[model samples]
Each structure stands twice: as C-alpha cells, then as structure tokens.
Target: MTTYPPNIAKLFEPRPRLKYLEHIDIAPKERSTPAVSGLSGYLAQLKSYDSEIQYTPTEGPIQKQQRERRERQRVQQAKVASDLARWNPSEDPQIQGDPFKTLFVGRLDYEVTELELQKKFAGFGPIERVRIVRDQRGKSRGYAFLIFNSEYDCRNAYKESNGMKINERELVTDIERGRTIKHWQPRRLGGGLGGRHYTKTRVWGGRTNTFGGPSGPRSVHQTRTAPRFGTRPAYSLRLGPTERRPYERQASNERPERDPRYGGKYGVYEKYKDVKTEAPYKYESRDSRDFRDRDARVPERREREPARDKKEDRTTRFDRSMY
Candidate 1:
C-alpha cells in the first residue's frame, strides 16, 4: 500500500517522476485462464471440500438444536394472542387521532424518525402527532402516521406530500381508511390502496387496446399533453353512451344509424324496415299475385284437396284387401 501525504494539499500535488520508478520492470500481459467444468472440475471441487467442510461437521448437532428451538419459538409466538391480533386495523390501540384527519404515510424510509416526519410535514398544517410504527425489535417498518389538527390539513398533506421524496424514498400518503372504509384489510392481508394503485393490473383490452400486448398503445387521455386533444371531447372512463359512439346505446334522439357497409339499410335491394312506409319483405307477403321463387328448393305452396268421408275411404280400403 502506498503511504498518503501528511498534508491534505500534498495529496492533490502531482507525483514526481523518479529514474528508478521509470526503469521498474513490468510483466507482459497473458490471457486469463479458461474456467474448467465436467468431471475434472467436479473432482477438483470434491478434493477441496474435504478440508473446507471440516468446520461444519462439529457444528451440525449444535445448529440442528438451534433450528429446532427457533421453529418451536416461532410456532409458540404465532399462538400468542397479541401476535395473532397484531395486524387488526380496528383492534390496534397504539393508532391515534381521527381516521379522517390522520394520514397513513407509507413507503417511508426505514431510517426516517418521527421528529423528522413531523418537521417535514409541518408546513401543511399544525401536526397533532407523528408515529413511526416499529416491530417487536424496534426496527422501523417503513411506514408512519401523521396526525393533523383538522381534516382540511390532512387532505392538503395527502394531496401534496404523496410520492414526495424523503431520505431517498418516495412516500405514499393517504387518509387513514381503516375506520372510514368498510371491509378494510392491510397489505399484509392482501389488500392495500397504495401498493395496488401502482400495480399494472389495469385491464388493457379496452376500445383503445382491443388486442393488447407488453408495449400496447396508451389511451387518448394518457398520451395527450393538453387538457383537450384538438376539438375531440375529453376521454371518459364511464361506458360511453355519447353521440357518434359505437357498440353502445346512443344518448341522442336522432334516427337510429344502420350499418354503413349496407348503405344504412338492412336489406340489399329492398327496404327491410320502414316505420313510415309500412313495407313488408317479399318473403313475408301472403299475396299469391306477388312474384317470388316457388321452386322445390324454395318450398312451393300446394293447392288444398277436398276431404273424403271416413266411411267411403274405409269401404275402398276393404275392397282392395278382398282383391
């Protein structure tokens, strides 16, 4: 190791070129050795293990006992009443302030302190209190709560401070919804508004993305920089019933638009539906005078024949049998 200069300024000074240092012999470069594999490498590894694993053999029995003890402790801890009820939103007594006026600040840095949180958010409103949740061992759980004096202050803080960086971590802030929202469950129990909000679980196969993919096109609202894109109406999430909309009921009282491919008509040559004309289709007409295909394939209508008396028909059938 080279010795450092006693003075800080001497460190920045350029090094002097000595004759002996310049004449020092340097080794020629050589290619790095290729890695070995297959049976030969396996044998080499086996040879090394005999000496390397000597320390582990003596510790095995001790380690086994420790593992069993740890497992038993974990099972015992899980049975404890406090441990079982640890994450219950309603039952936690340490939670302070009104749910409406308190902000549940999550995604916090583990090192951030309560005093720092209080001071950081002090500009929003008068902070009633600040609490950074900790585990049984007093390690920060990367979440905290800030209690504001009023709901307005809480709302302001929630709006402005969410996604704000503190201690190199983006904070996720929201109003305490445990009491306000029904059937509330924390993230640990598979429910959380913040973490899930950032998730890419949004269904992509909407009108804009009929056949979605990994690099699908974004919706009009997302891509547009301005509030309104040209003269087009603002994009809406609600199932559309607006004018000139497709695949849904129209909001207007105008005439129902037909298929544009068939010239806004249901029939190819004649009118299928006419509320004003009351014209019926050719096949639907019962008028025999009407010109229509009556081929075998088209099922031609037959003339009705006179009905014979049952007695006469029976007599004819008996005569034929006698013959």
Candidate 2:
C-alpha cells in the first residue's frame, strides 16, 4: 500500500476549507509537491465532470472548409462551360486531324455538285473532305463545309478560293474557330437583285433606229406619178364684093373738087382720111352690107336750077346723066 500525504486526503474532502492555504505551494518554507500528483488529481476531476464540459468547432475553420468546396465546384463548372464552347466533331477521338484546319461557306450555286466544288478547290490544297448540306427532300440547301488536312493548307485554300468563280458565280468562305463548322453554299444566280451580274445588251440593224432615223412598221405603196397631149379647130366671118351706082361715083367725084381758099390740093376729107378710115362711122345698110356699099349705090345729082333757087329750095334733084 502506498502512503499519501495528509494534504492529498484533504483534497478528497466533500467540502474543504482552503482560505488559510493561500500561496501555500509557492511559499519558500512550503514543501515542494510532485507535479505528477497534481496531474493525477486534475485527471480525476476531468473524468468526474466530463459530461459537463462541451466543445464546439470554430466559425473560421468551418468557413474555410466551405470556401474550399465552393472553389472546387466553381472550377469544375468553368471547365464544363469551356468544353461546351469549343465543342467540335473534329476534336472527337474518332476523327484524326487538326480540328482548327477547316472553313465554312454560304451562298453557293445549287447547280454546282459537291464533287465539282471539291475538284475545283483541290487545285489550291489538300482537301480532307467536302460536305454539302441537303434537306430532307434530298435537295441541296445551298451551303457547304470544307475540311483541310493542314492549317496552312486551309489558310491557303481560303485565301485562294474565297472569291473564286464557279460557273460565273463567286463563293464566300469563313474559317470555323472552335465551334462546329456550318455548311454554306453560294446562293443561286437569281437569288436577289444585288447578287445578280448584268450582261451587255445587243441591237440589230433595221430592228433598232438606224443612225437616229425612224424605225418601225412600214407600208408598201407607190410614191410618184406621170403626164398626157392632142388636136382642135378655129372660127371666122366675111363680106363679099358688090357693084357701085354711077350717081354715087359722080357724087364722090364732084364733092369739093378744089377749095378757093389757098390751092385746095387736098380737101379736108382727104386731110382727115387717115383719121376717119381708122375710126369709120357705123351704119345699117338695106342689103345688110357696110356703109361703103350703101353709099356707092346712091346716084350723083347735078342741080339745073339757079344757085339762088337751089339755095331757096330745100330739096334738090339729081341727074343721072351727070355721071
């Protein structure tokens, strides 16, 4: 049996008085106690009141754990988003090639076949594959995608064949980055007004205006004509020759043989003959002849009475013997 100190026994007391033992352990004259004893006593007390002592984890430690979990989840979500953004069939394990080496195109001619396009573009570089999208009805959708073996080859093909002509049509090409390449075919020649190419118009002679002259429907008819000649007759009237009386001739001969006034070589009648002949007096004759004929018919008369008696007699007799 081990013997214990009297103070140790007091420690087990139900109610011990320790007011007089103040600083007893540290006093110079006090006996030093083994540290093991104090340790054993403390262990006993802990066991006796173990249920009464409660422990809780610190807020800082719990918060640190939750932050670490959140960081891990965030990193995983970012990875999933990045993978979705750059998803591509060429990047799949089954497909073997540089995924970045490809191009998409639109605005393609419907009449152009995929083989024809591939053949045309194969001259530029090595083409892995050419795909022309088609609808459910097996008709082309007018678009395509082109895959090249090398990035440099794809770039060269893009540069050389971007605006390359195919059947009088130009094509457009766009490089596909991380996303799936969309097939784009060139639009038809008559797709829209802006994409159409204009052709030069032609004019024919006689069909169009010739040298700025009139040109249209014309009629066939005569524009000119010609000219026509002949013979006809004339008209006249006549007065025939007639006999003269002796008395009229004698009366013409005796009419003023001479004038006593100066030598009557020519009478006033002779003087005015030219004027009177030009303007002869008109008269009606019994035989419908001129006045000359009627005057010639009259007989010449010589008066037998005295000059005074002739003068007194208003009427005078004519002797035909005077002719």
Predicted model with the maximum TM-score: 1
Model 1 local distance difference test score: 0.67
lDDT of all predictions: 0.67, 0.55
What is the C-alpha lDDT profile of model 2 across 1-323, one tens digit per residue?
A: 13667878767668766676556356677658666544665887888686787777667978999999999989877876665555555555534445578766657888889899888888767888887878888788776778887788888877777787788878877675334435322223211222322232223322432242234432121111111101111111011111222332336556665655433456455655545434343324433222223344322321223223334332322232223
Q: Candidate 2's C-alpha lDDT?
A: 0.55
The residue-level lDDT of candidate 2 at 277 comes to 36
Tens digits of lDDT, candidate 1, 154-207: 999999998898988888888787788986766655566655333333443254
Alpha-carbon error at 173 in model 1, in Å? 0.8
- In order of appearance, the predictions have TM-scores of 0.38, 0.27
* Backbone clash count for every predicted candidate, in the order shown: 0, 15
